[model samples]
Target: MSFVDRLRELRLDAGVFRRATDRGANESAPSAFIRPRPIESRSSKEQSVGRRQSSNEFSGRRFFSSAAGSPVSRPAVSSPKKVYPTANNSSWTTEAKEPAGERQVIKVGTGVRPDDPPSSLCPKPRSPKLKVGITLMTRKPHRFDWWLRYHRNLGICHVFVHVEDTPELLPLLDSDEFAGFVTVTTGDDNSLDTHNPNSPDNYYTLMQRQEEQVRRSVVSARRMGIQWLFHIDDDELLHLTEPFSRLVRELGSDVTCITFVNIEATPKSLNAECVFEEIDTFSQHLMLAYRNGKSAGRVSVADWHGPHRFTGRYCVVPVERACILHFESCTYEQWRNKFIKHKEMGEAKKNDIPFPFYRDSVTLFQEDPSGGKNEQRWKAFYQERKIEHFEQLHEDEKIRIRLTSCPKQMIDGASGSFCKWRNA
Candidate 1:
């Protein structure tokens, strides 16, 4: 028999028709009393055929049961979908029925992720300003206050001082005038023994100590974020014709050094008590031995041969406007003592042909160790030389004259026009 005929026969035998007929005739029939129709038994071949047909009709379809007690089918999704958390603390996902070719970008959140690129929309941080500092190696504490005041007036922001004699000079560092700006340090305890012939410090040992002190100051300046560093002595005063900061900013990156020629200032009389006060007059002749202008940046102190030049590998830029005013011949007592010290340190042995100034000073000291008659002779010699009045000249004229008066040896291939003044 056919599958449908068999199903009919099985329902009739189970009395399903009687129950359905009774429910239709009585409108008041309870739902609980009305029984469901029993499924009819079928052969394995017939069951397999029915399952195959059902699967075919329901392929790519989903079913939903309605309130009217009927099953409805809708098209099913084909692609997988993902949900992501958004900025408003809510979850969202792409439409399952969206076309495969099109993609919508979802801003995940306002917060940054580990793999996200840095945001260019935000403002960048500002950089710090560059600073400059000066280093001084001073043996005389009495002149410290004066030196500090002079440079501070020239817009010097920071200072590093290495006092040669700390015990006598340490009290000066505590002054209120130098509270925030100045740093005081002591000389090295392991300084060279002047008496030992085999020691490295014996030969130019004083210069060696000065170099070591300067080196330490340079390192300290660098650590403190000082972009430019200048080294000067206690007796030397640097006069900047222009603003020091402007000069530093104008220097090229490749130019690491700046040299200034020295102009020796002599007193009218060797009997003058204070040379600093008598600095109104300066010598017309340029002292080739003392070129001691301050250096640029952090150069090695050992590289500095004298106050005038740096021997290291650097591009040296000479400042025509700025010059170091040296009070090398201040007083009779100071000069005599300085000469004696140099003589004891074997200065005469080192120089085969010493400068006339040194030779004369040593001769006079030898002839009159008391410095009474020698002072008068040196005073007469200085007075005979015509000295230029610094205050009377114009700023440009002073720079021009000094530059013109510089010795050729101090500057490479430099031809000064004031040749007549050298002999005068």
Candidate 2:
């Protein structure tokens, strides 16, 4: 390239730059490039006008300034922030209503939480102040004292006994433990007829009447400051290492009902004089247990009442914190005799009891004085029957087996001599 040509190009570029700079410095544009005009010897009238316009614009617009008493302008109208609510919060569910055509304030925090079912649908959890009612139907008067002492040991304050319909047994009902007895008689809603169900009509009537009575019992318990009403029979007991109150506390509100280990009563020896102590509460209380060789079985001896057990159908609690002690073959000698006589009454005289069947069936009958042999026979028969019954039930449904011959569970456990799951 020639030097003359290069020189001409440079001059042209310089002229263009000078022209651009002149336009910016003219001070007639909407806004000037430089700020704070210098104090010249003489200022143009146009420059003064432009500077005044720029200052007015700056004052009218919004910009943060720390200067005191400065005319602060507000921001221009713009869209609000968008918020998306999540499932962990309730802000979106209970949103505030907004005016028509205006932007709604959709919160971006957690969303709506699900509502739990009503207490009526699901009963509240068990409480420690539960009032338990026990009803035992026994023909023998001597057996009451044993059960009374046993229940006392079990931490029960109230016990209701229902002795069989016998005039001789009425006198003992005056005792403190037996005083709470609800002696169901023919006059009391015709309890005897209810037990002797000939047809479905009879069964229904009996069931309805019994359930009504049970409801009354529950009401009474509630009035006595019992938050939970437990219904149990004579042979049934609640076995818990911790107090009933603790069980309720640990289970919390999730547990509506709890099931316990159903321990069946099986005879340890054939001796009719074999007195079952506290250790027998589980093993020697039921007929199946006697036949099953110190085995345990489930019985519906105890249940809870409140909102939990008040469905159209009985709802068994899902948790296993509580168990029902099912006294399967724990009937007294007189009761066993009475049962045998009643079942065979159709073939025999109404008043004339079947002495042979009664005598053979009841090992612990007052008159059966054969030391251990009679009891042994009863135990053998019971064990055979228990084995048969167990075979009928699924293996998973079988009761836990424990030998009563082992040192008494109560004494051993109390003395720290018992081991978990020990065979002996």
Candidate 3:
């Protein structure tokens, strides 16, 4: 039996997978969970046309709310790790906290360049021009154009965009600013499900689609002669300071991947129409802002921090620099429209999954044959046990923006965000 099948059996054995009406039938039924939307592949030529069409496809918008509430609202937990000794009543031991100063030299390039960058003091040699690949998964044109400009201004030699097959994006794809600097990749909307794994409706096919997307996107960057592959979803944007070129020169060999600041923004009830504003800056970018509080223009989050397994929203292998911005949340209308589009896609495709996955406290996976009842029960139990904690999180919930100059000091093997750390 497949792992999923075994898992289903376990859920039943554990008394969590079935509804009270269910009798653990011998014959399985068609999965009620909708399949996830397919990821856009850079290899697809259709993406080059940048055509927006009306069909049953997922909308990249409105998956989450301004409150960021949704069944998908599971707070990404930190990766597992070894606990370091604490200072309480323990003998003080020491370990090197800072990265070792020495770097291993690595020569980059297929052939020697006429004007190659100088050999680094590190053992490795620098590549010709730093190649960067950028991914944006959105149907909207406004945010797409912004990212294009950022990469071009950053002197990045190449750019790749992943957007749904939509006509609204054609003009921008055809724009002079994007000329020669951009390549559009086609994405299928059918592979965008956000169902919980516990749901019997959750199909292995949906999970595979997501994995394929990550694999294909990374492979495309490798094919493009890009040493660094950066990721930014539709709503997210990256911010950076030093030209990536300078960063390549400085951290050439030691750096492999980079983590960037995640700046969470939301439409706030300002003086007039809802205006998008940053509420929190991840620690990395927080240092970049004027202590006096000035808005540093939007930047790609991939530029600074490396990818955390939990917050894969933005991250990349080392290209030339080490900083970027992430604008994951935007205005409410745009957000709502996104969910509406996804719902339409679901209905047309016959997936029939509810729009937004979570509505009026109902999760998209609630109908899945697996643990649908238990999942609901778990949520209710969580609310009951941690009512105060959940309320505090909701009440204090505000936009978060972070900026970090050095990521190595802030991240551990588990990839937890440590605002401060000392060797012990």
Best by lDDT: 1
TM-score-best of 1 and 3: 1
TM-score of each: 0.51, 0.42, 0.39
lDDT tens per residue, model 1, 1-424: 9999999899887798776665464333211101212222222223322111110111232121223221233334565232222222233333333332322121112112223234354333532444656776665533556666666655566887766534666666767778678887655544323223224223345556556656666677667767666676667666544333433333323335555445556454545544554445443233312332345553333244443334432322222234566777465545555555444434444442234455555555455555456456645533442122223322212222222212222111111221112111
**Tens-digit lDDT track of model 3 for 1-424:** 9999999888887775454324333113111111223334324433312222211122221112223121111122232111111112121211212212221111111111223334443234334665665544455544555555545554445555545546678678878867677766545433334433223333233334334444455555566666665555554444432334433332223334444433223223212121212323222111211111101101222232212221222113221112233333233334333333332123223333221222211232233323246455434422432222222222112223332322322110111221222111
Error of 1 at 286 (Å): 5.5
Any idea how many clashes model 2 has? 24
Q: After superposition, which runs of candidate 1 have C-alpha atoms over 4 Å from their true positions?
A: 1-130, 165-167, 191-203, 271-274, 283-289, 292-294, 298-320, 345-354, 372-424
Q: How close is candidate 3 to the true structure, as a TM-score?
A: 0.39
**Higher lDDT: candidate 2 or 3?**
2
Tens digit of lDDT per residue, candidate 2, span 245-323? 5434333343343333344443333233423342332221212321101111111222323211331111121112234
Candidate 2 has a TM-score of: 0.42
Per-candidate Cα lDDT values, in order, are 0.44, 0.35, 0.34
- At residue 129, give the lDDT of candidate 1: 42
Error of 1 at 5 (Å): 99
The RMSD of every model to the true structure, in order and in angstroms, is 38.1, 33.7, 21.5
Q: How much is 259 displaced in model 3, in angstroms? A: 2.6
Clashes of each: 4, 24, 65
